[model samples]
Target: MYIDPSKKPYPFCPGCSHSMVLDAIGRALEKIKADPRRTVLVSDIGCVGLSDKYFNVHTFHGLHGRSFTYSCGIKLANPDLLVFNLVGDGGCGIGGNHLINAARRNIGIKVLCFNNLNFGMTGGQHSVTTPFGGKTATTPSGSPEKPFDLAGLVSAAGGSFVARVKALDKEALDETIAKAFQHEGFAFVDIWEICTAYYMPANDYKKQQMDELIASYGFKTGILREEKGREYSRVLNSAVRFQTSDVRRQTSTTLTATKFSHTLQKDSIGIIVAGSAGMKVIFAAHTFGKAALSCGLHVSQKDDYPVTVQSGHSVSDIKISREKINYLGIDKPDAVLIISQDGLKEVTDILPKLDNGAVVVYDKNLQIPKTEAKLIPIDLHGLDKTVHATAMLAKYLTLNKFMPIEALRSAITAISKDKIRELNLKAFEFGTND
Candidate 1:
């Protein structure tokens, strides 16, 4: 069988009902003769995410609450694949709108939610699915809001099949999951997972207490709704026209020149400058980006700061690449410039990804700790930290012969105002001299 029965000793809390849920899912996969190569299981964040390591089939651990969205793309790309998404109540609750819309569109996918009534990973805080009067870590005084019928909501939103299952009822739960897999369109199954660790005693919810609480709130079990709905993949397959084997590939001979041609750099570099407000981090990124653009290099930059606007946090992510850059977000930068202690703290996590060989330039006066990246510290030189550090970085780049000196000079002259133009020119020369 493709599903591994011995995959656990599960990581769930002691007495957690997730084992039963996993059993039913495995049995369902067996009933359908699920092939490991054609199957992809997506796991949402929280306890359910642990299943990614347990599954024998191809799988991808998804962003918090976004497994279903990722599934849509995967299914759209290859309709023959069987994709299963496992989510916790918090995953669907925080991103409830995505759940309803996925059903409404009847995207070809099967989604199972382990509704334990709270965010399990974050200490059992009250989630959208938490029942009224159920107390959680956040809801110390019993919850006041009523929980929604997750199955009914999906059905009404246009899911082709919707069911509710109890973890304890293995035979029936397995049968229900099998039928959901057989459905041709969107399928949603809500499985009850008991939170044995915190929820049980926090709300005085023992086995019998759970029965009464659920009954009082009126949640149903078994198939709640089953009907035909439009399958997004089926419709898309019929609508799309493309050659199955004869694919057209782009070639330089067939390509046209873009206006950004001259700005294209032979090689690329990424830099992130961060610090508090009034440090001119943005100015530094702009100066460098403009210089790269002048050389016909593709440049992308992003800035982030706090609401205080005067002195909190600031970050600028810049990428200068020869190829047409696609994703804009910077993960591991080639270089990082620190202007203040606040900036260093802001990107502490990112600094670890930097290679031991990566360049790290900072203001020496900050007196921050050392790092693995090649450290280049500069004196403030009675000039703005932003300008000084930028000049230092430029000097390093120039020494390494990264870009043309003529290009950098032209950019500095064009960007700087009449008053500061001479000062910036002098600074550029100072950087090379050092």
Candidate 2:
């Protein structure tokens, strides 16, 4: 009854062993008393993924072999939440690296993989663990390679808990699932399900002979491994919050402030600042947007950064408009700030689309090509590009009398720390005087 059968009817093949796995998960959730709102179920594209709707939990079905990747983010965003990944053999077969790495990272998550010995989502086909010498749609002559060892891989990869449960053993599977759910670090459960619609009938496999079938292959059941390890989130929190005791907040009564809200005008602008990631370009954009919010103006800011977080060029796109800004993206940005050669390259990529009067702010150190857009160049001298660029941009806005100096200052003060606030205020003064 926990499952909303009216809105999300159970959709599984007749006699499919996947239902047992679903029941185990439901029982585990019930036993743990997990909050429906705080529990996220990320599943892959297969019969297992179909179970996503069966539960009232917030669920997302992702790419064929990357449900765990999505779950990683879900857990990271809300570390207090209980996250589970439901994937199939196809996901594990192709996502072995992801699985191993997630284990090694000891992410605080539970992973349930329905291992039906073949790709059960599709017709009976050779999957990541297709029997080495068994027949399937893709391997009519039988699999020549060795079937993957999912359990051993997770155990060796550093999962805090690992288990292989037979689908038919409902009590054992549910208990193991509950344990996995309670684990502090990464927990993996490999449930061997029979594909009644495909894999079962492919070899004339009968439901009555399942015990014999399991015995022949030495199929595993119950908790295979369990250990205690520092969870990824716990370790990360310790590192992030270390020596940060001064961040406690004051009483809401003392923090409260009166507000006069006003809408933005049609001439509202979009500004982009681009440079290397470590240069604080994203933070600068965030500061500016937050400042604009303090001014009773509408604003939105977005950042683009590569995987490395340090070496690659970064971009912060900000929009400020008077009226309800219909669109956040600014294809024809009103202004741009380029801090390095890498930033200039990104600017050039969209140079042709810039409007006739759009402005370009660049580092004087770079050999920027001439353009019809108004050019404002600054010398970095190895100084922070955020401070210098924000100063210059704020000065331009104040001089044009389009934006208020007090509003900008109030914003800067509202969001910045002591040293940073003092430095930025001085920078604003310098730009205003310049």
Candidate 3:
């Protein structure tokens, strides 16, 4: 029997799912009587790196999004010992092509994908798992794209065993982990955890939201069973040949709107510059895009990666012109919404190059450059003093008379009706009026 390390407790932030996954894996090991010295736990960058320091078992921390490749190598060399991988949604989803190819090869390793809906380790940025309309530091407006369902992806990618279980569901989760270990081939388990600080709402709002999600979706653990045979061996061999090409094709599909010229001409479009507020802008843009499409408007988007996390110049540009727009125009914003101090500093560049046509909206505290465009300054900081929710702040901006208030409200309601109504009604009212 292997001794549990006294320092086994990993240094993950409160509300993270890594601890539960580690415990479940450890319990699974105990159930199977696996020796710690022989077991190798491999993880990629981010919170999984902490596993190297915390777990008493032999551990390996690989490059960002390369945990599975390393696990493949380790298991291929030492086929007798057990190999496990602990990875986050960002690590898995970002490197999804490689992971799925690894699965198809029937690599003898167990994978615990900590699918906390978004990237927790990177300060709650929007990830491939971040559901549509979910808020994060990168997407203050809300995430625009829908999250990737790991179970379905892995299952279709030829994983011998695949499951999706909630982190809060201890019994079901524990059972899923045990079963994954028992499966004689590659196994994948996705653990859904909450990011309370970065991605989720505040304390009171989160509790209510959690209750609602539990009541609605409940907890689920999916399992796919595949017997080992000649067919399986044939499949594995063929997978290795297509792995590289398949991955390249999948990577080609990721959202790639880089230049301003590509983003601006939509009947109603929302552009999100990548970084701290990228999540928010994407959510808002997607919402507006849907509303516009429903109203028979062609929506296009422009997006670019930000230079850094805080204190850098960033912009989320949306073009809502009725006319057709094929070229990107940063200076022609219809009505701008500024969330961060960085946004305010870079407002001049965001203005549409048009003369006396665009509207500039920002917090009164920001120093709007003296320009030819009409400026609408709202006291958001003062409004925030009364309403603490970021969702509320977003809604307040959505209700401005200059923009499509009703459509934006409809988008917010469609995504998070209860939270929008309960948390931001008062703030929205005050900001709209004040």
Q: How much does each candidate deviate from the true structure in C-alpha RMSD?
A: 10.3, 6.5, 22.5
lDDT of 1 by residue, 130-184 (tens): 8887889989898898788788788888888899887777887899888888887
- Model 1 spans > 4 angstroms off: 242-434
lDDT by residue for model 3 over 155-218, one digit each (tens)? 7888888887777778888788887776767888877777655666522325456546435544
Candidate 1 RMSD to the real structure: 10.3
> Residue 430, candidate 3: how far off, in angstroms?
99
User: What is the clash count of model 1?
Assistant: 6
TM-score of decoy 3: 0.50
Query: How many Å off is the CA of 420 in candidate 3?
Result: 83
Deviation in Å, model 2, residue 171 alpha carbon:
2.6
Best by TM-score: 2
Cα deviation at 412, candidate 3, in Å, is 80
lDDT by residue for model 2 (1-434), tens: 44665754457788788887887788888998888998999999877878877789899988888888888888877678899999898899878888899999999889998988788878788887766666789888777878777887888999889998788888988899999999988999988778887777776665555566556668666788888878887677676666443332331221212133433455588888878766677766776665565555677887888888878788888898765677888888878878777777777867666756788877778776767677777655634555765675565565444556666667667654787777677766765666
